[model samples]
Target: MAGRALLVFLALTILSSSVLLPKARGNSEGDALNALRRSLTDPDNVLQSWDPNLVNPCTWFHITCNRDNHVTRVDLGNSNLSGHLVPELGKLEHLQYLELYKNNIQGTIPAELGNLKSLISLDLYNNNISGTIPPSLGNLKSLTRLNDNQLHGPIPRVLAGISSLKVV
Candidate 1:
């Protein structure tokens, strides 16, 4: 009952945000963020500021963008969030840091995240996530940090392919 209502509320909010974006600075990044926002169950309303109508997501809270308006970081650690991670996050070409630790996120890490060649850090510790670590993670050539999770299966040898990888 309550859960269903929450879902409805989230859907309505996103719908409202979508309707406003066309008249604002809407772009692909905003779309990606919208996907991410949709995937999350934000009970604290921390993501309320993530308005897709903005042409640049850089101005949104917990999101950092470069001077070129490219999203570089997403610091959403420990905000009492819960939900599955969407594959749309893989679209942040210039993203360097993706900190999503200490939440209740579940599901597999999307293989598409391997596309984040510019990523330097991916912190997902202390979560309820399951499934094997994606072997595609070996593609993060610049990755230096990876930490605690509830993953199963063998660690991919390709992960060794990342010369800069330090933590696992």
Candidate 2:
């Protein structure tokens, strides 16, 4: 009886952990999105559609996710979102594409964005963003596109040095 009870206890522990793990990961992803929502100043409420309470952001419009349920794309181009880019955006570790073009965003490109090791395309063209191009952006080895809109500064030498650059 003692051995049977021990086996049942172990089984329950394993089951409980298995159930909790996914929820923990989901909560972390949700927390990251919530942080992103807080950082931006949504003046026109364009992002009002992004409600964390309604459902997972993965199912929300303009958001794309991978099979592992990680956010991979955020395509909000030409949506009239006026705000400053926040450094916390770097928290989306799995982000692949970020399209916020043709908006009115104004501010320096956060250096923290370099932390997105999985980032492929980062389009912010036709906006009011200003400041020096961060050299850390070179850390994005996976980056395929890096478009800026009216951004001013001495282009980072690292970017200039990249042999893969098809256009500047």
Candidate 3:
């Protein structure tokens, strides 16, 4: 009888773990953004209002969320943010819109940002960012709006194939 009970307990533990693991992974999305925030040097204090302690980034300034409570938009245009874009920004798997235009951001556009498969619009215009636009950005098949920036490189042919692309 004790053996049977032990087996049942083990089964229950496995069941519970399987149910909880996805939630834990999903929570990491926000944790990843928080990590990215910590990496940035927010000199202009524009990101001062960002409080990671707050329940969700969606509730933070210039952020938006979808019905699933995942971050969908980040509009930090003209905020004078001066820093490097962290690769951790790629962890936002559900991000659809990212607007960081007209800032003092300087650095290579993170290749990891191409991991945002759900992204539809990305506006990085007028920033000081430099480097070759990642060929990985071609993976953003959902992208419809890509704006001008200081990006350098021969345009990737994959980007040219995007049926939804309008401007780059």
Candidate 4:
């Protein structure tokens, strides 16, 4: 009976850890998004649902996650949010779509964004963002859209490496 009880206890421990592991990983992404929320000016309270207290950002409005609870998309386009992009945005390793277009956002783009290896669409068009496009963005092999912003300076030659890039 003692051995059986120990086996059951071990099994329960493993099951509980498996359930909690995803939440812990997801919380890091949640922290990243919350950093962005702090950097922005949400006068419309559109980000009101982005509560950092949640176990994961998956439950937050405008945030999408994959089956693994990893953040995949951030659909905040035209939500009337302004403010500069935070380097913390780069921490979302699984982010695919970062839609923040047509807003009044101002300031230079964060170069740390180059760390997003899985990024596909990064729409920041029609914003007040200014500065040279980071050559590091060339690292995004999956990037497609990166245009219509108020950026200046010569386009990085390194971007030619991205065969998947369509609109820039």
Per-candidate Cα lDDT values, in order, are 0.90, 0.78, 0.81, 0.92
Q: Give one digit per residue, the lDDT tens place, for model 1 in 20-40.
A: 556644487778878989999
lDDT string for model 2 (9-80, tens) is 999999988885665445555566666667667666767767767445787677899998888998888887
For lDDT, the strongest prediction is: 4
Query: What TM-score does prediction 1 earn?
Result: 0.83
Badly placed stretches (over 4 Å) of model 2 are 1-23, 41-44, 161-163
**Model 4 ranges off by over 4 Å:** 1-26
lDDT of 3 by residue, 45-152 (tens): 766666756656766767788887889888888877777788888988989988988887788888888999999988888888888888899999988877777778
Q: Which candidate number would show the highest TM-score if scored against the true structure?
A: 4
Candidate 4, residues 35-130: lDDT per residue as tens digits?
A: 999999999999999998998988888989999889999999989989989999999999999999989999998899999999999999989999
**Per-residue lDDT value at 40 in model 3:** 60
TM-score of each: 0.83, 0.77, 0.80, 0.85
With candidate 4 superimposed using the best TM-score fit, by how many Å does residue 19's alpha carbon deviate from the native? 14
- Between candidates 3 and 4, which one is better according to TM-score? 4
Per the 3 Å backbone cut-off, how many clashing residue pairs does candidate 4 have? 0
Worst 10 residues of 3 by lDDT: 20-29
| Model 3, residue pairs in steric clash | none
Error of 3 at 19 (Å): 5.3
